[model samples]
Each structure stands twice: as structure tokens, then as C-alpha cells.
Target chain A: MRSVALQKGLAIAVPALVFGFLVAAQWATLAAPGSRDVGIRYIDPLTASLGRLQDEQTSLKAQLADVRAKLDQLQRAGAAQNGTVRDLSAQLDDLKRRAGLTDASGEGVVVTLDATRAAADLTQDRLPCFAPDLTDIVNAAWRGGARAVAIDGERIVASSSVYCVGGTIVVNGSIVSAPFTVTAVGPTSSILAVVDDPSQLSDLKRRRDQQVVDLRIASVPAVTLPAYGGPVVVRSATPQ
Target chain B: MRSRVGGAAVAAVALLLGVLVVSQFRSRDVYSRSLEQETPESLTTLIADLNDRNRQLREEIFDLQLRVDRAQSQVSGGQGTLEESQRQLEQLEVFSAQSRVTGPGISIRVDGPFDDHALSDLVNELRNAGAEAIAVNDARVGPRSWFAAGANGDLVVDGTGVRGPWTVRSIGASDVLYVAMTRTGGIVGQFQLIYQRTRFTVTRENALDLPPLAAQ
Candidate 1:
């Protein structure tokens, strides 16, 4: 009788357990589709999200580079537009001269004069005329009307000089052997008048009387003034 | 046999359902591999294409950098030229203004009655006489060139080379300059060359041309 009761209990328990398992499995199947674990199928959602972030970073960097390039272009354009701050003619001429592009030679009148010492030109038994004689010659030249003038093939600016001490004549602060020729561009009448001045006459007379150095004057109608070709050193001058 | 066959058919259907259920559960596996299909091929293609584009861009950048550098140097040189030209023009203008004169003027030339010493003394007198702008020989009448005597007997004044005709011509009021030139120690009185007839003549004239002004 105990064996039959045991057999009866197992038969009933076995069928009931099977039915419960079926119902549980059906519920599990319905829930499995909507779970977070579904994200693992086909592609790992986390890895995909990481890949998207990397792509975004790359895109952002490219944008930044583009912006930087645009900014640089704009700055360069602004600098190019800066206006000239000085007079153009002066600027061009100076630049040209520095580059050895000067057009400062032409047909002009040439003046030649010499200095000789004598007794009458002296004062207190001493030589009274000095470098001032040179001054007289240049002034006369200007009065004669010269556009561009030079001494011994060297262009003379406002800063050029003539220093005479003892027996030396310095031109532009440099000693040069001379039968010095001063050239100018203008009509011959004014040039002749300049040559016929009184101071020049006196210097000639003194040279003849005392036989100081040597005195002579010659006026040339056609003389080609050569452009000065030397070191093109330049310094800025204080503006007036 | 027929009953056994029916039982087998049902068992087969149940087995199929069990397999389907297991497959569904496998699809929801949390421990799935991170690897994806065709990963290497896609990455390789992307890398190769990007590298090509990058190389082209780098070449362009290098060329542009060179061009920009050259342009910069050119601009710098141009600016320097502009500045130098301006300087020359200003110097010319100053000269033009100081030398312009219109009217009766006096011309005085004194190189030396006897020697360079006589010329120097006359120079002192000329300065005392209020002479303006002097030069000797081919040299100019600058602070350094003043009193610079010509080795070949030439005297420069105001950049004009004067030899014997040490002409000093004044515009307008040369009388004052002349008066000052002839002071007791001036060339008019003390210069030995004047006494020796070293050629000293002072006269008033409407015009005169000792020489051309030096041009630099």
C-alpha cells in the first residue's frame, strides 16, 4: 500500500511540474525581446556609440582648422591694405637711386677756375683769401641758374663741401685732384654773367700779380654731366 | 505503429519549439563579442582615402608657405625703397629754396693772391662779411669741406668747383656781405694776393655764373 501511494504522488507531481515550466518559458520568451541584453545582438551598442563619438571629434577638428585658415587669410588681407605713409615721388626717387637707377646726367655748361696766391690779395702781409673763394664760385653758379650741378664728375648735394687749407682742395670732404669742372643746365647768357663777376676778376688779377698758385676761368657751352656712380649711402634728413 | 508515429510527430514539433526558444534566448546574450563583420576592410578603405587627401593638403600648404615668405620679403624691400626715395626728394627741396634769388647781385672771387694761406685768410674775412653758403673747388661748403683747398689749385664753394675765379655772387643785399667781407682782417684789406694782383675784383651785376652748382 505505501508503494502505490508513492507512485500516485509522483505521477501527479510530474504533470504539474511540466505545465508550470511551459507557462514560465512562454513568459520568459515574451520578456526577452525588450531587455537591455537585446542590445548585444547584431552590434555592440556601446562600441557603436564610441565610434560615433570618434567621428564627431574628427569632424570638429576639421572645422577648427578651417576656421583658423580663414582667420589667417583675413589678417593678411588687412595688412595689404595699409596705405603709404610717405610722399610717393620722394619715395620712388630715393628707392631708384639706391637701386642705382638714377637719371642724373645730361648736356650742361661747365665752369672751370683756378686759385693762385699773390701779395695784393693778402692783408697785414698775410694771405687773406681762404676757402671763401670757393664759396664765391658756387654762389655765382647758382645765380647763373643750374638745375643739377657737380664737381669733378661727382654729384653735389646741399651737403657737399669744399675745404681749402694750404694747397689742398677737398670736394665732398674727399681730396680730389682738380682742374675742377662745375656743370649746370641753363641759358648761356646767365652763365656768362656769372663768369664775368668782380670777385673772379680780382682772383685772376691776384694770381697774375703775386703768382700765388694759378688762376684761370673757362666757360664750356656743351659739357655732359655724368651721373654720379658711387656708393649710394643715404641718411634720413630732419624735415623742415 | 500508427500511434507510435503520432507520438514521434508531436515530439518533433515540441523539439522544434524548444530550439526556437533557445535561439531567441541566445539573441539576447549579454556576453556577445564586440567584433563586427568586415571591420578591417572598412577601416582600411577609410584610412587610405584620408591619407591621400591629407598628402594633397600638405603639399598645397608647403607651396603656399613658400609663396607667402617670398611675398613678405618683397614687401619689406619695397618699403625700404619708398623710405629712401623720400629722403632724396626732401634734400633736393631744401637746396632749391635756399639757392633761389632774383635781382641785382654782387660777385666776388678770391682764390689766392699768393698761396693757400692767403685764401684761408680771405675765407675768414668772407665769413666776417656775412657770406652765405660757401664751397671750395669740387668740394662743397660744408662743415668739413669748408676751407678745403684744392690740391690742383681748385677751390670749391656751395659744391661748385672754383679755381682762379673764386667768385662770390650775392643776390639782393650783397652790399652788406661785401662790407663784411672787406673788414680790416678781411680779404679786401689784408690778403697779400690782393696786393700782388692775385685777381680780386668786386663789382655789382644783375647776373653772374661762376660755375654750375654741384649736383649729387
Candidate 2:
């Protein structure tokens, strides 16, 4: 009987051992280096396309810088030669400054909106509404007397629109993700008065209270806003 | 003793099989989660967005190059500075809402109950679609314009009270503005979903005039 039991055990143990070995081997192969490429193979083409687009953007930006530099040089030269040109140049500069085409710096406020730990859990559903909240903050800043404003380093110009497109916040045609930083150049007191008031930004205030987002406002002695970099030509509108 | 030994062997194999299965499943779970974060569709959208931005940058570069050429010629020619500067100033003034503007654009008339937020969204959509100038009722939207709910649920633009049927006129490419406002899931559609009673009529106009912002 003992011999028979041992024989049965051998039958079970031998196959089980072989099956276990096979599984172990397969697991090791999957865990091995370069095995992850099986999944990445599907993403490779998309990754390559993204890389190409990024490189194109870099080249385009360089060209823009070059052209803007040349325009500046010509403007300076024209201003130096004639009195009327100089006067017009000054007027143009003022208009450009007011139009947010020129960089601005002064005592102002910085408002930052960041997703909290709780926000991470609710991001997909709740975070898309961040655009309107950001709009309210910016509008409050403007009402409180901000001369120039920028969100996440993208200057807010006359044509800048803060809105959501597929769960992303777009400012001036550029996609930005949180934590959103808004820098405004103007009277700190005035900006704070409007921004700090819960009435002006009720939705953001409620979201902050619920710990959905963290809102911070700080007054700085000097804050500089970058000039608008997007297309500025009036292609369709004619001045009357 | 032989049976015990066999049982021990079986138990050890079972443990090994269980571990292998768990590890395999864990790895697969991680891989799938990572793929979810960057699906092919999302990546394609990102690529298309980047392409659009690069196109805009190229256009900006070309425009700037033309300006530089014109400025260089004017500086050398000595007669075009005043005209060029005046032209640039007028453009800037139009952008800043400091001068009146007239152009082919689109007009939206809201003939029902709507809040300032809806108006703000409409204006934002117009700006996103390249509206060079915007005016709601009689109030011109400037660089620092803000829409707020005034007393009694009235719509206020930069502290100016405006009543409905509100007419929003924007200066831009008429076709582009119209498409932006009326497209599926656009502002008009969104408003239709939220404000059921409101009627939004978007008309492409050959000529629309927008006045400068009233002095603060």
C-alpha cells in the first residue's frame, strides 16, 4: 500500500512540478528587461508623432523670435531718424503697453489655484470646471484694477480666452494644467479687495471651502507679466 | 511517511503557482492602467493641437517678417514711418477697445433669461475663435473687461448695466465666428441645454460697428 501511495504521489508531484516550472519561466520572461516593449509597441507611433510636433514647435518659436527681433530693430531705427516717427513710436508703445503686447511690472497680486489631495480623487469630473473659476479670478483681478495679467506665464491679452477643452484649460490657444498661477500687475490693495471678497468669486470660494482646490493670494512688491506672444494682427476687424 | 511527503510537494507547487498568477496579473494591471493615462486618441489629439499651434506660430513669424520689411523700407525711404505707426496705433487702439471698429462678423441676440456667466462664456468663445472686437449691448469689452451679475440679476459689463434682449456683436471673420457660436457643444448649444427658455439667434453680418468702451 505504501508503495502504491508513493507511486500516486509521484504522478501528481511530477506534473505539478513541471507545470509550476513552466509558469515560473513564463513569469520571468515577462518580468525580464525589454518585455515592456510589448505594450509600448502600440504607443510608439503616437510617441514619434508627438516628438515631431514638438520639434516643429521649437523651430517655429525660433523663427518667431528672429522676426520679432528684426521688427524691433527697425522700429528703433525709425524712431531715431525722425521726430514724427519718435512721437508715433511713443504713442505706439503706450498703446502696445495697454494692449498687453509689452511686458509689465509693478506692485500687484499673485493668485494660485492648485488641486488638493481630495481634488485628485474628483479631478476627472470636477476639475474641468476650473476654467470658469480661473476666469472669475482673472475677472476679479481686472475689476480690482489689474493692468496686466498672466496665467501660468501666458500673458492674458485682449483676445485671450480661458476655457476648457477636453478636461484641459486653454489660455491664448495654449493648453495649461493645474496648478494654475495667475500673476497680475497693478495695485495690490485693489486686486486683493476684489479677489479676496467671496462675493466676486463665489464658485471658487465654495470649491476652496470644500477642499476641492487650494486657492492662495499673495501680494508682491514687484511682479512682471510677459508680453502677449500670440498672433496680434487684426485680420478681419477694421478700425472705424 | 510517503503520503506526507507527497502532500508536501503538492502544497509547495500550489504556492508557486499562486504566486506566479498573482505576479502576472499585477503586471498586467499596471500596464493597462498606464495605457489608460495616455490612450492613442488622446495622443492624436495632442499632436493635432501642437500642429495647430505651430501653424499659428508660423503665421505670426510671417506677419512679423512682413512688418520688419515694411519698417526697414520705411526707415530707408523716410516717408512711411508716420503712416505705418498710425496704422499700427489704430490696430492697437481697436484691440484695446480705444477706437471704434467695423467689420464683417457675427451677431448673437439672446431674447430670453440669461445670466452674466452665459454672456461671459459667449464672449470667451468669440475671443477663442479669433474675434478681434466684441461688444454686448452698448458696452465694449476691453482687455480688462469683466462680466458680473448686477443687482436684481441684471447683466453688468465692467460696471455698466445692460438689459436683454441682449445683442452681442463681434468683429471677425463672419464664417469663423458663426461656426464657433453655433457648432455642436459650443456656447450656444451649452446655453440651450442649461437655459431652456433662452433663444439664441446668431446671424452673420456683412458690416457691424462696435464703439469704443465708455470712459471709466
Q: In DockQ terms, which candidate is top? A: 2
The TM-scores, chain A only, for the candidates as listed are 0.45, 0.76
- Fnat of all models, as shown: 0.03, 0.50
Per-residue lDDT over A41-99 for candidate 1, one digit per residue giving the tens place of the 0 to 100 score: 53354336435543543454354345434433433442354444334444544434432
Q: What is the lDDT of residue A214 in candidate 1?
A: 46
Quick one: best TM-score, which candidate?
2
Over A1-240, each residue of candidate 2 has an lDDT whose tens digit, in order, gives: 989876777677667666776776676555443344345454678767767776777677667767766776777787887788788888888888888988899999998886554354334322234788788788888889889999988888889888764445668766565678899999999889998886778888787788667788899999788788777758888887
lDDT of each: 0.44, 0.77
Model 1 residue runs over 4 Å out of place are A1-87, A90-107, A115-130, A198-201, A205-214, A227-237, B1-72, B76-216
Q: Each model's interface RMSD (Å)?
A: 39.4, 8.6
lDDT of 2 by residue, B1-216 (tens): 866776887858765775666555443321111212344565567667777877889888887777777888888987546666777788889888889889999999998889987787788789988899999988999998988887766799998889888999999999988998899978899888998998989999999999998886
Put down candidate 1 lDDT per residue, B1-216, tens digits, no spaces: 754555455555555555555545443332211123213333344334334334434443454355445445545554322332333345433232222223344566664534444554444444333333333432323211223335477654443445665655543346665666555665566554346666566666554322223453
DockQ per candidate? 0.02, 0.36
What is residue A213's positional error in candidate 2, in angstroms?
1.2
